[model samples]
Every structure is written in structure tokens, then in C-alpha cells.
Target: METEGVFQSLPALPLFLLMFSIIYLIAYFIVFRNWSPSIRPEASSCLISLSHGTPAVFLATRAILAGQNRGFAASNTVFQNLVLDYSIAYFLMDLLHYLMFFPSDLIFIGHHSATLFVFLTCRYVVSHGAFAILFLLILAELTSACQNAWTLANARKGDVEFAAKLYDFLSPPFYALYSIVRGFAGPYFVYEMLVFFMTGVADHVIPRWVWISWIGVVLMAISVSILWVSNLWLELYRERTKKLEKKMR
Candidate 1:
């Protein structure tokens, strides 16, 4: 596949360092440095630190899983390949979110007219940039889990269907809460929208046909949202019916 060829042609080390620097900068400036004194009076709380560390923890766990799987060898070549792929993908999105989209806040906030533009812009930039990185890290973990399920199915006669279902069940609530907070409660929905667009760009890893299959899955998710709404209404109706029956009885 040209996947290897494309990755090999890039400057892997520099890109990796750049990606790491972006991650660090976002963590320090946004989460740690700007953390309100009202939230914490002393050293950062464990919860706060863990919240900041979640993305790294998630990625490190995935790397460990990938190493343990014989299919993904822990040798130098495998390490290099994974580093190159992730570094390129991560850096491209990081640059897009931090460098490109962040500066546009000036235009949206009226640059000079809005007195809060400076603070809002900083908050918006950091939140959105962190979100993009976090989302990509989650996707990487999910992809690894999917690969692991396939490996188990082929090599060990495991139930791939069960693994897939379990992963699916867990993903939605996480994504729902993330989407809500990132969309509604955060600085601006525009940032979340941008993150969503960047995610679509990152899905370029697969061939066109395979990518279309992913789009179909996304469409199915939209349908599922409709069904979820219907189900909620049905539950409410059933509860009301039970109450009427009890009153009559």
C-alpha cells in the first residue's frame, strides 16, 4: 500500500516533536496555568491532573496494547511505522486547529470592538485545540480496539461480534457527553464544528470505498438518533399509561 510510502517520505522525528510540543503547550497553558484559583487553592487536585492527563493515558494504553499484540511487533521497525503514521496525522490536525482556526477568533469577536476578545480568543483556541487532540486520540484507541477484535477472531477463535458490540456501547455515551460539552457549554460551537471537520479529514487513512462504508456508518448513526428520540417518547407514553391504569385500579 502507498500508506507506508506516504508515511516514509515524511520527516517523522521533527513531526513527532512538534506534535508533542503542541500537546504540552495546550496542557500547560490552557488547563494548568489558567486553572482558576477558585477551583484549586494549592497544588493541582488529582482529579484536575488526571483530567489533563487523560489523553496521554489513553494513547499510552493503546501503545501498550499494540505492543502486546504479536501482529503489531514491538520492534524498531513497527515502532517507527506507528510513530510516523500517528505523528503525521496528529501534527496535520494540530496545526489546523491551533494555527489556522484559532486566529480566526479575532474576526468573529470583532477583533478590537470586543473587549473580551483577548480572553475569549485564548480560551476558545486552547479548548478547541485540546478537544481536537483528545478526539483524535480516542479514535486511535477505538481503531486499535477494532484491530484487536479482528486479530482475536482470526487467530484465537474469539467472538469479534461481542467485542465490537461492547466497544460500540461504550463509545456513544462518551461521545454524547463530549459533544454536548464541547458544542454547547464550551467557548463556542464553532470550535466543536471545526473539530468535527478535522476528524473527517483524518479519516483519509482508508481507501475511498472503505471510507464510504464509514460514511454509511455515520448515516446509520443519524438514523439511530431518530430512533433514540422515538424510544424516549415511547417510554414516557408507557409510564403515563401505567400511571392511568394504577389510578383507575
Candidate 2:
């Protein structure tokens, strides 16, 4: 009886794969085929342009200061250094998302939304993930620049005050909310992917190329995490600088 039960269970894998494949094919043909093109590439380009341009403008202003012997060289260095740090952070995070999240989402979700909730949730996950990571990188850079500006102001006038205290006060709560939502999304995605795999549909409908893409995505995610850690180190460095400055005065 035990052997028979085991044998019977073995066939479920193929069945699961079959069901998943059929559903995926139908969705791909009927739904995805008709949907509007994604604007993600445009958004990504805009973000890169904004990030690169911000530092360029700062550097240009400092260059003018340096010409006048007003301590602008140091300012230029500060801005350039922060830009390099942020660029690296952005690259790594993007690489990771492409490698891990993209593949996992495609394999599991694949544009199959049976209800409005699922569809909205899927869109939110993909969009919010991109926006949040970009926002985090930008915020880190802005924070670093603000700290630097504060230090410079104090050096010149003997007192320093942050201009955006209200904004800073609100950031923590928003960041917390973003983290909570993003944290749960990953596990839920994996669960759904597992369900599709068990149904044997993943193997049947999802081409080999798609599977290969997923593997690449996983590798990218790992790379992104590594970069994120480096970015955190910069944050720590900023905090340490603040503490040291307080001790000095």
C-alpha cells in the first residue's frame, strides 16, 4: 500500500506542470499579447540621467568656486566622491533585481491575474520594488550631501542647522512601511513559483531560455545585496563623522 501511494504521488509533478503550462500559455496568448508595452525602460533611463546630472551640476558649481579660491575644490571632491558611491550602489542593486526578482516573478506570475487584486498587487510589487530601491539610493546620496553642507556651514559661521528636519522626521515611518511590504512580497512570490513548478507547467510551458534567464537573475540579486551592504557602510561612515564632529565641539 505504501509503495502504491508513493507511485501514485509521483505522477502529480507532471500533472502540476501541465496545468501551469496550459494556464501560462493561455495568459501569454490572450492577455499579455493585448496589454500595453511596459514603460520601465523609459523610467530607468530617466533615473540614471537624474542621478548622473545631479552630481555634474554640483561639480560644475564647485569648479566655479575653485577658480575663485573659495574652498570649492573640496566641495567638488565631496560631490564627485558621493556620486561614485551612489552610482556603484545603483548598479549593484539593479544587477541583483534583474537576476533574482525578475526571473522569479516571470516564472511564477507571468502576467496571469485572475482578479483585480492579483493584477494590482503584481503591478505594485514590480513598480514599488524599482522605485523603492532607486529612492533609497537617491536618499543616501542626498543625506550625505546634506551632512556635508551642514559641516561646511558650521565651519564658516560656527553654527549648523538642518533645513529639512520635517522631511527627515517623516522618512523613517515611510521607509518602515516600504520595508514591511517588500519583505513579504519575496516569500509570497517563491511560494507561488513552487506551486507552479509542482504542477509541471513550468517545465512544459516556460522555455529553456526563460529558465536560463531566471538563473541569471538569481546571480544578479546576490551581486545587488553585496553592493547594498557597501552603501550601508557609507551610511555608517556618515554617522561616525557626525559623532566625531560633536565630540570636537
Candidate 3:
């Protein structure tokens, strides 16, 4: 009863963060122990994300649909706030993963930090503008399961034959899905969000710098994703070409 009361009284976001941390620990120490020592943390990270990504897409979309009348900069609905809290918790866990296991990974660390800033501000500071943010979340995480599966497969490819085969099988489709989401649809939505905010609609509810900064971070994330996927495509092409040359010989 005492513990239940304390937990019930705890604030939502921090409590949610605690739950994510517990999940990460269990994934790392128990579920993924057979994975490569170096890969264990990341695999666990991916699992943690798998828990959030697709669910977030649905939750955010539901929130958007429920609150359509409020417009883009309107105050967050209950579901929208829950989605934001869920995402903030995931990013916090992921950031800690990078910080603990791979401190040298500055780009990811910085990316997570920027993302948390965006979510934190939305969830706490301004409290409005979740419409744009959650809609963007839906776009960004639509491919999360595929990407995470591909990532885990790629990680295990060197030692595990099935993993290598799975990686090969999944890469092209995963890349296609990711390219469409991050490259095209996401950018289009960002443009819409920017127009709304910049054209003076979001201006009244969201601060000038706040909305600009949010969109700016999202644009940067999209640019990096595009570049990353472009490289992956080139690498896949090179691999296929090498195989074709060998077959001809």
C-alpha cells in the first residue's frame, strides 16, 4: 500500500523513465545475454525502442485525430501528452545507453540530446504544439520496427549465418521503407509544420524561437537520415556488383 501510494503520487514522465530503465536492464542482462558482448547493449536498446516506436505512431495518430479541431499549435490532448511522455522516456533511456557504453559516439549523443530538448520543451515548457510534434513522431517512427530489426540482424551478421542471411534479406526493403519515411513524407510534413509556425498561426501559441528550433532539429535529423540511407544504398549496390563480377568470372 505504501509503495503503491508513492508510485501513484510520482510524476508521470520520471516514473515512465524509471520503467524504461528497468526494461533496458532486463533486456541487457537477461534476454540478450547470448549476443556479442559489444552488441548486447545496442540490441537491448533496439528492443526498448521496439516497445515504443510503433505504439507511439498509433498513439500519436489517435491523439491527432481526436484533437483535430485544436489545430497544430493547440494544447495537447491527454493521449498526445501520454505519447510525448512515452517518447521522452525512450530518448532518455537511449541517451543513457550511448553515454554509458559508447561515450565516443558524439553524434548520437548530440542527436538524442537535441531530441530530448524538443520533447521536453513540448511536454513541459510550452505544453501546446503537440499536434505538430506528435504528427512528426508518427512519421519518424513509422519504420522503427523494420529499421531496428535490420540493425540487430546487421549486428549479428558476422558470427551468425542466419543473421547474415536475414540482414541481406531485410536491407533492401528496410532501406526503401526508411527512405520513403525519412526522405520524402517526413520532409513534406516538416514543411507543413514550418509553414504553419512561420506563417503566423503557431506564432501566437508557440514561441518564435521554440518552434523554429523544433523544426530546425527535425530538419537536421531528416538530412542526416537521408545521407545515411544514401550511403547504405551505395554500399548495397557495390556489394551486388562485386557478387555479379565474381559470378561472371
| Candidate closer to the true structure by lDDT (higher is better), 2 or 3 | 3
Query: How accurate locally, in lDDT, is each candidate?
Result: 0.38, 0.36, 0.88
lDDT of 1 by residue, 1-249 (tens): 476566567765566556555654555456446554432211122222233234444654454455433221112233334433343344343333334335554432231222122212212322112232223334333333333333222332233467445544434444454444433333243344344444555333322343343334333433443455456446546866897999999
Which candidate has the highest TM-score of all? 3
Instruction: Kindly report which residue stretches of model 2 are placed more than 4 angstroms away from their true locations once superposed.
Output: 1-184, 222-226, 233-241, 244-249
| Model number with the top lDDT | 3
Tens-digit lDDT string for candidate 3 (59-177):
88888888756577898766677778889999999999999999999989989999999998998899898888888899889999998999999998998999999999999999999
| Model 3 spans > 4 angstroms off | 1-10, 68-70
List candidate 1 segments past 4 Å from native. 1-206
Clash total of candidate 3: 0
Tell me the RMSD of model 2 versus the true structure. Answer: 24.5
Q: Count the backbone clashes (under 3 Å) in each candidate.
A: 0, 11, 0
Instruction: List the candidates' TM-scores in order.
Output: 0.23, 0.28, 0.93
Considering TM-score, which of the candidate structures 1 and 2 is the better prediction for this target? 2
> TM-score-based ranking, best first?
3, 2, 1
Q: What range of 10 consecutive residues in model 1 has the weakest lDDT sum?
A: 119-128
**C-alpha lDDT of candidate 3 relative to the true structure:** 0.88
